[model samples]
Target: MIPLQRISVSTRTQTLLTRWTKHVQDTGATTKAARAQWKKAKAPKAKVRTALESMARGAVRCMYCDDNRATDIDHFEPLDEAPLRAFVWLNHLLACSYCNSNVKRSQYPVDADGACLLVDPTAEDPADHLELLLKSGRYTAVSGSAKGEETIRVFALNRPDLVKGRMDAFSRACSNMRDWHQLCQEADPEADRVAQALLDSPFIDVVHAMTRLKPSVAAVVVGPRTVPALDAWRSAHGF
Candidate 1:
């Protein structure tokens, strides 16, 4: 998961959600009841989900996995803990069924300090807490951050299929970059097209891994590191 800029919902929708939340609160209903109400009243609305999918790169990928097609709206804060935010636009994220139903499924673990342990892609830059293992396409938590550990556990971010998917994407991206480099060596104008394709690839994290430049949030966690292969690749491209 990467950080995503959440889009604003229509004012009419926000007002309706506020009123609905207030009504649910007034009833003194159980979390389960509130969730049921949210599903009944809001889950079927396509416009809100369309907006979220728009945020997930025009519906091609899940906001969580960044690999699968987004098929559901995942509540960043599970309704069991923060039911009031159930219909709030910022709390919603596009997710795949595997990440949403099979893995996360209402599991919101918190640390002993009572702080949420899971990563909220909209609120946190995931790279700050998580690192990608390029060789295996698996994820590891930064030593001091429980957020990454918990998120990996809850989302099964290292599940074999997902790892394989990431590895495949990384391989494809590397191949394209190499081809682009070859084109440049031959003084071919097509090098630009190849470079553009790399930029446009859905597996953007691959490029991020190959470059030293990273989101500021990541710098705070990992500091600076020298990966010889990546550094060599970047230098060859004069990047």
Candidate 2:
């Protein structure tokens, strides 16, 4: 999962959420009971979904896997588990059907000490807790963070199809970066255009990591194992 900026929603929507939350709190209902009420009410209509989609960078990809187009809004704090939080705007994330329905449907695991273990991409940087293997496109848990492990398990981030998808994205991004490097060598006017294009590429984070002079968390996750041409370009340009 990539770090995402929280987008602003209109005051009208915020007011609605604030009012609903007060109503839920006034009833003194347990989270489970509040969820039951929500199910019957069918709240968070189209407007809420639209705001969430905008938060997912126009719903270009799932916030969890970052491998497929996001098609649904997932409750970061599952409704049944934390019903008062159900309609809260900050608790929403955009997800693909496979990640939301097939894999992570309402499965909220907690650590032995009872802390929620899943990563919330909006609240934290995933690279701080997870590592990506370039060759296999699998995620590994960073020490001391249960967030990374549980997220991978619940979301099936290492499933074969997802691994293949990541590998393809990585390869394509690297190829583009290589082209950008060659153009830079001749001081070509087109070099800036290629650089901008890299920002728009799928899995563009890998290229961002490659171009930095210092080792970044993203670079450590995918590298220290070098692609020779890409490494040479990074060394020359990043310095």
Candidate 3:
């Protein structure tokens, strides 16, 4: 999964959150209250969704799988588990229904020291924990990091469909980069369109993985001709 950057909520939303959280903290049915407030707090939810959509990568994709379009505001720390953080912006992330509701519903794994074993893409780089094999579109934990392993298991990051999606995305990237390069070679202004096409493609982490691949390795997978275009796009975007 690609890393995500968190953004701010509006002042009114922030104030609403503070009020809701304080009430929850003071309530007898804290989790219930949080849930109730979440349903009632329409304005805050809409603004949070907007902020997350802007911060989201590749057409507002899920922060966990980065494959499906994000539609749910997931509690990074599940509301049931951490009621106090229910309205906290920092504890929120955009996710797809499959990942948020079906796979990772309130599943928060932790180590013996109480450290989070699940990798939060917003808090830390997922690549540090998980090494994505570009060709196979499978994720293997870097040095078998527990966090990476858990994240994969929890989200089914290497599920067959997901793997195939990633592999297909890589293939598309290679073809797209070649087109982008052709436009750039001719100094065509429309190269921007191809660049945007690359961005619009699903499973965008493939571009990042290819860019970071060793020159000799990348030559074999993404091809020697496509490398320059990928690099140029990456540089132009300041990624």
Measured against the true structure, the TM-scores of the candidates, in listed sequence, are 0.77, 0.76, 0.94
Q: Name the candidate that leads on TM-score.
A: 3
Among all windows of ten consecutive residues in candidate 1, which has the lowest summed lDDT?
221-230
Candidates 2 and 3 compared by lDDT, better number: 3
> Which scores greater on lDDT, model 1 or model 3?
3
Indicate the residue-level lDDT of 233 in model 2: 58
C-alpha RMSD of candidate 3: 1.5
Error of 2 at 12 (Å): 1.6
By lDDT, who's the top model here? Answer: 3
lDDT of 3 at 71: 95
Task: Give the whole-model CA lDDT for all candidates, comma-separated.
Answer: 0.72, 0.71, 0.85
Question: By TM-score, is 1 or 2 better?
Answer: 1
Tens digits of per-residue lDDT for model 2, 46-161? 65777766666322678888767888778877876887886788888888999999999999999789888898878887777777766566778888767888888999988998
| Model 1 residue pairs with clashes | none
